[model samples]
Target: MSLSPRFYDLLMKGSFFFVGGLAGSMYATHHHHDNLKILKQDLNILHPPTREFGHAEEKVEVSKDLAVRDVLKYGNPGPIADALARKAYVAAYDRRLRHSAWTAEHLTAASIARPPTTDTSGPVDRGKSKFIEDEDLPIPFRARLADYFKSGYDRGHMVPAADAKSSQEAMDETFLLSNIAPQVGDGFNRHYWAYLEDWCRRLTGNFADVYVFTVPLYLPRLGTDWEMACVIGSPPNVSVVLASKPSSPLTPDVLELSAGAFVLPNAAIPDTAPMESFVMPIEAVEHAAGIQLFSKAVKAAAKPICATTKCELIIRKFDDAQKKPNLRRAVSGLV
Candidate 1:
């Protein structure tokens, strides 16, 4: 066959172009793969593959075996300006209320292991520690032991004495008037309140550490005169009671720092009362207290596992939680 000169020339050029293109593609592919491998190595150093997406793998080292002390975090929520009674437990005393706004403690099985230093019912030996005025307070507003005498209210403790069982100094610190409140005598303080305290100590059985916030809530109350009052202190100051008839039109939500007691058990309470009954959301407390209880650091350190109301554990017997025959309505006329 006779080939045209133009056709031959075009064929030779096309062949040369194909060979050059092929060589260029092979070199580019090799270089691209090398660059990709280097990029992958850099990525691996920055972030290795985790077990799952949106998850991170980290290695944390600890110097000592984990203790309850190592787990719990501390915070005080109050007039950040107020003096703090930093003892075995901590309290923020409100001189205006003449009571602690809140008392907090970190409890553990080991922390509460020791027997109570003093008899639970017996008289406190002043030699050990006495309920004296909190010199910590300013003079005019200080609460004194004399104020509680014959006041028809027990010098109630926000932080129970039993929680301070580990040491005499700790137990004694609990007796300070700063930590005391005018709690109702036999029914609430000595009975139901005591029961709650016992339940708190019992929690050590389940959790390594329990962070507790013992708060005093002065909610609205019905007075002897059938008047509504927000009781603030032990001795009801009649002047502070706002005279508003029930029939009157409401303007704003009226809340009295009158009376309510809350016990927030962190872990599963003994299969008794519905755990939901005891577990309270921090927001509820913050609303009632008009103060933020948990700070950012506290929230970050160990978020409360039972902050939500979802509960499945029934730990205590219902009937057993009933008030005793002799138990008077201690919170009566108060809440």
Candidate 2:
């Protein structure tokens, strides 16, 4: 899928609002419709009144109908979810799933560039960063560090730490639990997934701007009834996927956009597997996820990303060093 710069601007600013609603809707529709009603009532109570207060002498007793109308004059603001803005990316935290429903980042050569040696805060270092619970989230809604401990899954990043290399603080922000989901470590996160993240970063070399949206989707198993279940402690995160749209200036008044959406199973994907095998239509992704990613005008004018650039992965293995530690942690049931 391809998009105009105008469309990209709109998405970067408002995508999270749609994603947050999508996550809340999925959670409510699948597991808690009744709870949603209660949530609406709670939101009504928590939402500040729009009316201005008056002096005691000027105050008047408003009718119940009038009061209700005043409260809803602008329409109901659905269940409130966390809209997180980090140093390098923005994300919508899914309180019910205890992870991000989706994360968005804009990549460029400058944005992902490594800091200079003379920098005061020091160059971005992944080793110095540790996975931590997002304290900003309510205690009950936060994805605890203990949840992934010994869960036989990696604390997979939706927005890769590599994309935040411009600063140490940027990299550290990527470690927040709000941006993580459970993923198979060896073949998926450490290998193939890392390659995909690298590919997104590499797009900066080809296009002036690369916009990426990472979303975790609960796709139904083939030939089986749709079921949504996750273990309490070790939540089974769903199929993780991302859509990338790169736009370059074609002329002073025109831009060229190319896009592609790829869905990868949370399970390990072999290095030999062709990247094209995972290619999916952008509309399919929107339908399955119940969120519109782009406008029809953008979709109509966009070019297929694979046609614009080689849809291939550059193999780089990190499992040799990580395997032992991951196995040890899995055995000890600790992170």
Candidate 3:
């Protein structure tokens, strides 16, 4: 097909974008047709940089094998990301999500394996997950989640303990730290976790139809780092996935609505919008933590955390490159 140079340029750019994950890496190893297509299309161009696609294929070492690391960052980042998808809280290993593709190279090259996490009833001993004793913010209030820090809230994860023994090797991908987010017990155990489990199976069974790999869509704001840990696979689903059950309130979605705990559903989505996917409802979150959210803004769709279920989302970075502040709303600028 004949096309304008500009249009052809867009096709090349789009192709570069399309081959973004482990699949792309696989292409590097095996797909001569794709390679030749790129070459034939670009042969007439003035000059092809030493690196054609900028940073898509840079090599890096991770703690384990290079092959494993590449799969983690690129090939499987999407599956893990999908498994980790939840409405609230800043999860552990979240920092990795915002890294640029260049970051993948660093990880792959390092081949440094990530330490595993466990469900310690007490604070983690250094190498485990983070629990910085800031002494400033009322971790007490957050840890216990009582009356203090009325406005402050916790972001707990639907999947807890970060235990890889949770599921089968194929399914264990969901246990990656990338798949976790701050969540409340009532919300998660009762509804969110189950929903996530169901979601995970669906992805495994039917997601190949929609597999576009990704890089960190945005830079961490203020240079804050997001963390991640490797979740090795196990037989049968992880014990954690099975243990993830949310107990219903005396009634479903009916918790003691606190001044802050509330749920306000968004208006019927616009017709022009793409498919809409939302996390659990505010009622579910409220029911889990025994509190309400956004009481002041009862009309808004946002919810709040309970005092006892204390969790918090660490805002890592912002995409300040954009001229205007409000427009940069995505976690990753491109995402």
lDDT of 1 by residue, 1-335 (tens): 12134322322221100000000133333432342233233223223454222312233565455563365435323343355655468777777777776677777788877654455544333357668777777777778878887776678777778887666677888888888876544323554445556655665665545656666643343345967545334321000000111222373343211111233211111212322233333433444454555544444444344331122221222345575343222111111
Q: Per-residue lDDT for 1-335 in model 2, tens only?
A: 12234322322221111111111123222322232233223223223245432322344685679888899899966555689999999988888878887788988889999978684566668999999989989987888888988776688888989999888889999999999887656556776677678777888887777888887764322222534322133222222223333333455346677887776544444454555555556665555454567777777777887778776666654357656422110111110
- Predicted structure 2: clash tally: 1
Question: In candidate 2, which residue pairs get closer than 3 Å at backbone N, Cα or C atoms, i.e. clash?
Answer: 1-259
Alpha-carbon RMSD, each predicted model: 32.9, 15.1, 23.4
Instruction: Give the total clashing residue pairs for model 3.
Output: 55
Q: Top lDDT: which candidate number?
A: 2
- Residue 105 alpha-carbon offset, candidate 1, angstroms: 0.4
Best by TM-score: 2
Quote the positional error of residue 225 for candidate 1 in Å.
18
Q: Quick one: ranking by TM-score, best first?
A: 2, 1, 3
Every candidate's lDDT: 0.45, 0.60, 0.23
lDDT accuracy of residue 217 in candidate 2 = 60
Question: By summed lDDT, which 10 consecutive residues of candidate 3 come out lowest?
Answer: 234-243
Backbone clashes for every candidate come to 12, 1, 55
Cα lDDT of model 3 by residue, 125-228, tens digit: 32343422222222322222222134121222223332222223312333233432222222222232333233233222211111111111110111124342
